[model samples]
Target: MSLAVGAVSSSKNMGFDESKDSEEKSHVSESSKNLPPPSPTPTEEALREGEKYNRQMSETSLYATEEEEDDEERKIELGPQCTLKEQLEKDKDDESLRRWKEQLLGSVDLNSVGETLEPDVKILSLSILSPDRPELLLRIPEAGNPKGLWFTLKEGSRYSLKFSFKVSNNIVSGLKYTNTVWKTGVKVDSTKEMLGTFSPQAEPYTHEMPEETTPSGIFARGSYSAKTKFVDDDNQSYLSINYTFDIKKDWPSTS
Candidate 1:
């Protein structure tokens, strides 16, 4: 995860490939796992110098900490938490430390560093890409548009989903993307993607999921309700959206 390593070429709308049709549903499924102890919560370190010092770095499981809603296990501690400013103030004298701090923080307002102790992530837009047909881009309202209809996809068409977002406040660890789709009250598709750790930076991050093809035939074309959510390892939910879309036999008219 943390698939935003490469900058995605920007555009207002989802651009269609116009070439050969390809791709399928994109999902980074997450298997529920327990969060053992706590590895240092990135630059935002935490906890005691006793057992904390002795704990192995591997304790913060490489996989994302599953949602607390479905998991019965309780959250221990990601370590003693501290604000972003606290992390940056530890070593001011060393030149290397100064440079690394700048590199990690990136254009952050020094005055606002103490405003929030938790990481803030904003989901901007969602791009739906299907080969050879016009793609769709869903712009998310600041408050989230979880009502009525959203967009449509072609039945049996191979497509992928990508998201653009911005992170502020502090570093976000174990960022997870979960989406569950349903048709006529029956759950059809569920996806959980673990977007790895990311530091706060001026620029936004773009993540593309694996490709997915819609179910074909008469039964596949219809309206569907879906819910998408973004959450961090510490169980802090950033945004949740509920929307509906239709799947048609042919692509909707672009003109």
Candidate 2:
């Protein structure tokens, strides 16, 4: 009886050991199947980095080429220079054309009855003259010189404003004169007068300034412009001119 019991106990211990070994082997196989892929080699990582750098360089080079092409497209090449003689001839032709137009317009008959009215009136001259000082007349300078209409106005003094016009058609119009001062502030003085039916055969009309007090604050030593407008019967402006002048606190000493 004792020997049979010993044999049975030995068999049971052996069976338990075999079962544990099989369970451990199955667990190891499952763990290996669930594991992530191995990391890339250093060489492979370097090759990928090199490829990315090459792609960036290629893109930058292509962009630079496109910008260069655009710059070339926008660059303008100047034409051949004209000869001095050619330029002079061109200027002469322009002057002749201008004179022809003036003469043709001047000869037109404007006083004929039932003739259509035209805004062909021309301002012959416009000036602000000082009777006391003949040299102080405001004059329009020719172009390419120091071009500006300038006058030196003395405080508390009066000036004469004159303007003349020539018409090529029978048009009833009026003169609207305006004097303004503007800098840090603005002030305006205006006057209007009727001019009856004007014709080319009529003499140029002239007017002088009326007696009036100059605005007090206008004599501040700065720059200002005086403007005049020629308006038709309906108050529509057809011609305008402006003059710029400076104001002085005191007149220059003659000595």
**What lDDT does the true structure give each of the candidates?**
0.77, 0.55
lDDT of candidate 1 over 95-115, digit per residue (tens): 899899888667777675565
Where does candidate 2 clash, by residue pair? Answer: none
RMSD over all Cα atoms, model 1: 31.2
Cα RMSD for candidates in order: 31.2, 22.6
Q: Per-residue error at 78 for model 1, in Å?
A: 1.8
Q: Quote the lDDT for 209 in model 1.
A: 94
Model 2, 3-44: lDDT tens digits are 999998998877757778799999999999999989977798
List ranges where model 2 is wrong by over 4 Å: 1-116, 135-137, 140-149, 193-197, 213-219, 250-255
lDDT of 1: 0.77
TM-score of each: 0.65, 0.44
Worst 10-residue lDDT window, candidate 2: 80-89
